[model samples]
Target: MSALIDRDEFPLLARAPELVYLDSAATTQKPRAVLDALRAYYEHDNANPHRGAYALSARATERYRAARERIARFFGLADADCAIFTRGTTEALNLVAASWGRANVGAGDEIVVSGAEHHANFVPWQQLALERGARFRICELAPDGRIDLDQLRAMLGPRTKVVAFHHVSNVLGTINPVREIAELAHGVGALAVCDGAQGAPHLPVAFDQLGVDFYALSGHKMLGPMGIGVLLGRREVLERMPPYMMGGDMIEFVHDDRSTWNVLPHKLEAGTPNVGDAVGLAAAAELLDAIGMDRVRAHEQALVRTAYERLSAIEGVHVYGPAPDARSGVVSFTVGDVHPHDLATILDARQVCIRAGHHCAQPLMRRLGVAATARASFYVYNDESDIDALVAGVRTAKELFGHATV
Candidate 1:
């Protein structure tokens, strides 16, 4: 483990000495800075925004807008107004499905999603397609758990209105070529929508560079507070799309008879928002920026490489996903004769927290021919000691399962 980052920088890790938090793919542990930000917001600025002209309200509104700017800059978006805040990645996807899909996708039009998408990314499109009489097509995954580019090319056509897929597989950990996929979607006259819930935190992402129509990411999974996510799209696209919700704040003019809606971001963010969570998310983004995304990527890649090598060395452990070079920070595997749930329990007993089960990617699990698997995901705070604990926990689990060593 490199001594680049001090344990004191992350209070959660510092306090929880026995806890090996390896489930970052699910939700990351909040850093001290983020928690402090959340505390400061609630303790001081507790006013509802965009309504009152009071000092508190103005401060709240300023904080909210600044959070948007922070997140927009983090993603390399051109305009902060283009980023709409939501509950989380699930809500972000649903907003796009309701707004963009309703306006653009119609009967006989096709929407393509990869088979490896989490249910958050899959069900919204599926439900929308059912509602609009649109054709829902899935891009097949290769044996190594990447999108089959040949099949993607064949499946896309003139009628394809939207291509929604994960930038990184939540289950397989396969990093999709966003630029290539976006270009392919454009070739078929389709809008490329990327589910960045799994990608944004681990990898450096540029919305403009990827040429994506929309990108969704969760705050909790990126060491920020829960209940806040971002949906970044082109200003033109969001301006044309209808609001997902209707209420005060998102209105231009209103009467008993009719009303006009607010502009880009406010239109989508209806009702009172998760202001504190958004502030925490901005702080988290700033922390990530300070560390530098390239360094973060390098640290995670090193952890993943170390994890893959160590886990693969253990007998009866079947690892999933592409090679370490092809994947990011996730490692999903199953041990022989031990149920994933059982393995998870044992690891938990050892204070080695890992995610088990389908990980909200049931379709991908079906493709992998498993009901569940144990997944260990690394993050910026993780080090080789964490990986060693995971490997040891798995070995102990296998031994408890009474498997013979080869």
Candidate 2:
């Protein structure tokens, strides 16, 4: 994995030699391949796809369809048309809430979501339940921050319509058992929706193998650009739901009184799409595939192990989330007498970039009894030197705050 980072390939990392970027969970740094692919698409094939028949349009359509195929193949989906492009994970979840939830979930139905979900995953379902007169249920989190599977089983019943949860907790870094959870949802005759924003980039995600009805992911969280995300659903299930957004390109025909909708994927993707971002996302997925997810996961795991050991050794530092062996790359902690915002500012002076906020998981933060925490999350390019810089930064912050030890 060390060979994966060639200084020549990533000129930005070389340019900012002192910067230790540990915020991969928020968004990862793009590789040269993804950047070049975006550049090449805008330079050569800059045309609206699927509508025009000229040479440029033909090339654009080919590239767009190829991207769908690449993403579908990456997730081991049978049909590329099962995937739909959206703004990000937030929009993807909203689509599910508006389209599938509106159609399948009703007055007596129940929608179950985990307590540890990001606001993107939680609010959409909550809103849908409220509007449709459906019962909204929350699955409790265990002491270690993972979902309480026993509680989840007890909550699932005939009234349950959809079971929504994150594949990995953004704050806790607790990887959920998607296959088991999906089976449990199916046992209760409910659809399972997985928010894969955090999981897709760090681990190997095979949508079919996970047995989920719907899986949502963001491009930026991986190595792709912003404003692009994906929602992969089972073909038969998606076909049953009404279109979430109504506009051009999503319709087969329009009349004064009624309008007919387009086919599977197109029906879901409305209006002018984010073509360049989709191209960049495809390139990002290709880059990750080349590196191999297993290798990427292993690289990040080693970094997390080292970070956990070093941070835990500090006297006044309190680490959150699962133990080192039971976690992903995310490490959240608090320095004694220093607010997370202050700790972040101190760390930033040393060129150490870490996240300090609710991390979009305010409910989880409340559960942990902290308003915010300082988080250092790792990725493929992060190494031991990065962890060392973080350790040194924390020590400097402790000393600057007049703490004799830590």
Candidate 3:
């Protein structure tokens, strides 16, 4: 077994040494730096960020702005003001659908999305197209669970106003070709929107180089706190859109009859922002940058390779997605005749934590011809020991179910 990561940095892992945590695609365990940053914010710099005139408020505002800049830099975004804070990736995608989709997509227009999208990315565009009288088209996936680019190209036309797709499938762990996809959309004069919730956590994403108009990311998936995410958009596109939520912070001037909106990102962010979580996310980004995303990706890749090789050798274990090199750290599979939930419960008894069911990608599940799957996802903290534990737990489940080995 490979040596484990320094669990001491994450108190949860440190406390539970016996537990095997393989559900990182759902949410990662936070580092102490992130927790300390959150605590320090409330202890020292807790104030309404943009509206106050006092010292604490000024300090709070500075930190909040610094957090935004730090996150933007992490994603290789040139314009810091293009990073708009949202509750999470769900809210970020919704903001795009409501603000950009409403104005840009007219009757008879088309919004293209992939079947591999999480419900967060899928439902919003579908509903937005329904509301706007636009056609919501699904880009079919290849047999290997990748976006069928030929089909996507055939679907894109002059009426294709927007194209939305996940940079990495949360269920299949298939890494979509973002640059190529964005180029396809741009060729058709359609704006590309990438759901980066999975990609941001595990890959080094250069937003400027991706050629996408907008990318959505979540903090909690990247060793940060919950309730904080970012919608990094092109400044030109964002400036043309309307405010997502009309409220106190997003206003420039409040007339009794009509109120003007703020500039750039502030126009998109409404109400008191999640300042504390934003700080936490910044600290998380700092931690990732310090370690380097390339190293993190390599680490997860090693885990996936080890896990995939070992699990695929087992009888009746049908692993999904591309090979380890082509995918992220996630591995989804189903054992013969054993339900995913039942298998998950058995694994839990062995102190192995995994995810089960549709993983919020019901369309992908249906495409795979399965009701659900048992998924084991890796992160920096996971090692071969975790994979071994999961394998043993699966064997135990097979034994208990009286399944014969090949």
Candidate 4:
């Protein structure tokens, strides 16, 4: 299948036609629609939300609310209040760890996470466990770079307070069975936390149906602007947790000694909201919804599989993760004796962009017995030509590195 949208739709890619952007896993190329939405927000509704009494401020507040509602509906969330605007997945996970984990987790309790988690997901929980005297249990990955379900099941018990894992592995592109993981956590009476920074962009996500207590996603990875993300939590769970922050609009009443908190989202969001970014993200969600995620997923899979096959056929190349059918559009690999940074530099020389280093997955890197790996990830604006450029650049890098990979 062809890509649902092409480079022409992305201003950056359209201007640099020769540049092959395979780093969507880090951040996607923003569509013109998203950029337009952002510009429109600033031009028309540029004001502080919630606290302002003026007309422009009122419009900004309404835009923020409407954006939240639209994004909630996009992700199958029934109540927009349950979706908290966050700086990014990092901040969202930290909020859960700081508020929910702090309140609920205790001594001897277990917090289970997979080896494949990004640092944002892994570190907060680990730190929480350490601070609370809880057991930070890590479920190591299977040989295929996915979390071992059997291992996870054994890790969960009555003492388990949380079972946190990634919906998609940023390093290996393995798509974990989120529903099954959530079910296993629920069986042990634990809350399921999902690091959905990667999965939400390439897959059709229904937050309510995914059976997770908290799901976090980044806007920049899904054709939206940076500085915007969402943490979709169950309403009941959110109500029980204390406010993650205080000040700004997240207040009901204030006194000299004590203060009452605001309701739902405002209770969690403590500062002036990023109305422009939220508007951009809502436009991105609408664009994706119109194009249909089913088609987007299929197109990405096709591109990644092509890259996987071509890369694997090279004698010195080693591809990580499960088969193409079992993962998203990310492909992490290494060429014999060629450092990932060096390979990335070579690729850059050819106007092909790919992510290098540990890919922010240092634990998984250690588990896979590597210091770093080169990653090529895709999105709707990516197509076969990008894959072709990537393969060619990689082949060139192998030759330059004295590997003769072909």
Q: Is candidate 1 or candidate 4 better by lDDT?
A: 4
* Native-to-model Cα distance after best TM-score fit, residue 359 in candidate 4, in Å: 0.9
Least accurate 10 contiguous residues by lDDT in model 4: 397-406
Quality of model 2 by C-alpha lDDT:
0.89
True-vs-predicted CA distance for residue 366, candidate 2, Å:
1.2
lDDT of 3: 0.93
| Candidate 2 per-residue C-alpha lDDT over 131-157 given as tens digits, one digit per residue, 9 for 90 to 100 | 999999999888878889999999999
lDDT by residue for model 4 (207-265), tens? 98999999999999999999999999999999999999988899999999999999999
Q: Residues 1-406, candidate 1, lDDT per residue (tens digit)?
A: 7623566678978988888988989998888899999999999997999989899999999999999999999999979899999998899999999888898889999999998999999999999999999999998898778899999999999999999999998877899999899999999889899999999998999888989989999999998998999999988788888888998789999989988998878999889978899999999999999988888888888888999988898888889999998998899998986888999999999999999999999988888889999999988778888998999999899888788643
Candidate 1 residue-wise lDDT at 157? 96
TM-score of every model? 0.97, 0.97, 0.98, 0.98
Off by over 4 Å in 1: 404-406
Candidate 3 — which pairs collide? none
Model 3 per-residue lDDT tens digits across residues 1-406: 4533477889999999998999999999988899999999999999998888899999999999999999999999989999999989999999999998888898899999999899999999999899989999999998777899999999999999999999999998999999999999999999999999999999999999999999999999999999999999999999999998888789999988999999877889889988999999999999999989999999989999999999999998999999999999899999998899999999999999999999999988898899999999999888788888999999999999899643
